[model samples]
Target: MRRRDLLASAALPLPAWASAAPERVLRVGTDIAEVGFDPPRVSDRTSVTINAHIFESPLTYDYLARPALLRPQTAAALPEASENFTRWVFTLQPGIFFADDPAFGGKPRELVAADYVYSIKRFFDPRIPTEHLFHFENAGILGLSELRQRALKAKTGLDYDAPVAGLRALDRYRFEIRLARPAPRFVQLFAVPGLTGALAREVVEHYDDELPAHPVGTGPFMLQRWRRGSQVRLVRNPRFREQHFDSLATDLNAEDQALLKRLQGRRLPLVDAVEVNVILEEQPRWLAFHGGEIDVLELPPTLAPAVMPGGRLAPYLAQRGVQARAQVDASVRHTFFNCEDPDIGGLQPERVALRRAIALAYDNTEELRSVFKGQGVPAQSMLVPAVYGFDATLRSAAGSGDMARARALLDTYGYRDVDRDGWREHPDGRSLTLRLAGLSDSRQRAINELWLKKMRLLGLRIVFEPGQFGELIKNSLAGTLQMWSYSWTTSQPDGDFFLALGYGPNAGQANDARLVLPAFDRAYEKQRALPDGPERLAAMRAANRLMLAYQPYLPHFHALRVDLSQPGVEGYRRHPFTRDWWRYTAKE
Candidate 1:
């Protein structure tokens, strides 16, 4: 709906903060444009970051928890699990209401347990391309998958009214979920507000296909304006419930202690508005922050050494009263080969040899030094630090750089310069060329140049296909991209999702590589089913070995996240799990 139409539809006064002073508006920059606000349809970090403020989930991570601890958001308390983690129940906080919307007929709308139930069911609806369906499918929610398959075979929309034995609202403010298998960490799914936020059925039915633009939820902020690919403005929700800043963390640094002392009982969303601009280039974004136009910045790696030398704020920035916080992120950057592609995919000996050769030739150290400014640690395995199932003792050759071994493997696989053109050819003398998809940015160009040099050293011809990140994500999901390099960050402390990249069932979702090895899938399932112990560790290690042997993905490095805030911005801290930190900060 147009702004005028939307305003005319509601008979309500503007929020008090709507006319507050301009300083109440906090401005920030994103490195890329968001895909959209539709949680189910989005898989990118930028979109999820923006949506998290406008949506509320059952649970959220504590702001100061180091390893990341989950706490209740809309829920009255932590969920109760029983029956060996097969059944879970959640009780919603009473009297909570969604942000005002025309779908509510201009009357206050109370949030209920049914809203959460309907929101999750939307993922199974065939009409929607839910990128996180693999998460729900992996949970083995009873009868839900069958309902989806039934709709698929019937060629019709899912019967949302159909009573699934496993998923149902027990009452107006409580719901129950029964799973087919044990899921000890299933509650972690509740912490992802962007994907699992509650949505009223009426609002969904009203907007229909336009739900992405018309998001209504019981969150602190509501979308005020959106200029696609340029900027977005979010204002405090007029009907947001009263909540105070609090944490259960016992161990906090002096900085957090001071922040808590000042803002402990203050009403949330200290800022009245959040304005996010899509600044794709690092130079422009860095300049914006340096000039005080941007309130917070992640501190681009290219400028990190000069701006915040030795992991501390430069003297000049500190003189300006700027504050900085840094931590090694729970993320892994990697280059993935589409296992379905004919040239570098499949289990055939020659195809596997080609992929292994490429993996061996990758230079992680040079890329880290040149592109990341030596601000990250070389990734030893798929799992990064601080996540469960990560074993520092386990060593793998996936991150190793060896040109000699790569050349010998190619030679043994019959890849040679048949025509003496300094580029290798297939066993039958067909020219070999590899295409790598990446964002069209200077950082990506630098990384791609590294790949170009590495491939040339191995007598292989390689080309970089540059495009917008959103379009590249679509190509990756479709399994059409030959290869691509990107980072995968953990949403929950458990790092199983990283291994899910190779799970046979996740091919069209998180598994961009399209790998479907039965052995790897077995190990992955085993680890998920077992409790956290030596048995589970062994299972995960076995799966990691399969990934290294197949060379489906060449792990790069784990980045160090360094964020800086302007002088008067208070209570700014980066959480490893959640992205909705705007609520905890204020600007002077």
Candidate 2:
């Protein structure tokens, strides 16, 4: 039903349950500040978390599914895929309206297939700086890349009115996308709300460069207030179409089954509002949780020993009705060396040996024990355990720390203390020093100390260059930083996103290491066209081996995420694939 039809009645009566109950609010916290609300413009997890609530995608993950099943969101059903996996069709649900906005002149605007088409086009516009352009380029979306190239060469804006063979709206409620090559895992893009959400053309044109501040969508929630990097507030969208809580809930454990029972038919956005505070410090976030200012807390690794002694919730917290849940997050942390940096960059044997020695010398075990408090497992490759094409039996010397081997490799590469300065010199007798870019947080300082110790033990000079997290990201993308440490969390169940980190075309975007090996890129593309079987898996492994052989990035470990919730918070569960959980949770 249309929103006006439902809200037209002036004397409508409220339900007994809603009329008698107090306003429900869910308070949450994040360790990082949000960069912006615009989905395509931002890549940070904090911004994505906020954008997920204010945007509507074609599909979303089932809330109660363990294996991350996909379900239709704005669409009436799952997309229809062609036999060759090149074409996809989606039919939008009728009568769904965007949140009330000035762009619509105070009238409710219905969502249509064109909104999604325009949103996709936004990523290809040369004027917009988007990090996601690589994915669509890699997907070989029919004429989109050629159009983008034309715009770039012409030094003009993308001709939105121009027709493209690959992307088109079939009708008012239906759209089609045709890829040039097979992409079996391409459907996963529909499930990512933050990356592929529909955007109204009217709203985009009305706001222009200010669109990030004015996000209007057909989701269950609408942005009420935003304080840049400080805080974000969202309220239930009164014009949202009727949607009840329902899921397949397949293979759920006993605890999840009970949760499904409780939330089976509840209206979405069970809480009236959601308030997220940007708390960058660990101690303050913990204090806010303990003081009841925040209803949910993602416990930091440094505090794990105190809150979860011996991997169990403490008695004092349990007695107070606090609950703890821990899961191995589908993420991989690594220190990447800039393959384009003049100092440590190149395919020369000496340069490759230097990187391999450094990777061999760094100890993942020590980092997991000291910094993570035994909250992670050593990572064998860029592929995390939660995705396909991950081989647990795969082994590599790059991930295992061996001081003796590292020294021998350095010696073989002509690196030695030529002047007896207790530091290694380059093959040409030039002073060698490694500069690592890091954040200014206390946690980062601890990690940097470990890096310093490891490098010093090998008689290699290392220095720390600390800056804000966002600043480091910019510098890394510009290929100005020699090395930087960070983590990437997968948003899809496919391993392609992780492997894209080494693809040459993704240099300034996903490939922060700027690795430009043609062989690895060939293997990555070859696997994308193959079916998901032993052949595809072998291709993925070959690509991974090429990356490991070069040693552009030293794999660290996969972190374990620990979450604590107050007794009043109900229906809260950490999803393995999605980050937006506020709509499913409520506070007493």
Residue 327 in model 1: lDDT: 86
Judging by lDDT against the true structure, name the best candidate. Answer: 1
- Candidate 2's error at 500, in angstroms? 0.7
Each prediction's RMSD over C-alphas, in Å, is 2.3, 5.0
Clashing pairs in 1: none
lDDT tens readout by residue for model 1, 27-51: 8888978877878898777888888
| lDDT by residue for model 2 (1-588), tens | 332232222122333454456868788888888776778888777888778888988988998887879989999999999959999999999999998888999888999999998989888999887778887888888888888889999999788878899999999999999999999889898888777888888998997876777788888778777775677778788887888888897798888888888889988888887888998889999999989898888898989999999999999999999988899888899999999877688888899899999999999989988988889989988889889888899877765669899999999999999989999999889998999998788889999999888899988999999987777777887789999988998779888998999999999888989999999999999998988999999899999998899988998998998889999888887777787688788677
Give candidate 1 misplaced runs (Cα > 4 Å): 1-14, 20-23
Candidate 2 Cα outliers beyond 4 Å, as residue runs:
1-21
Q: Which residue pairs show collisions in model 2?
A: none
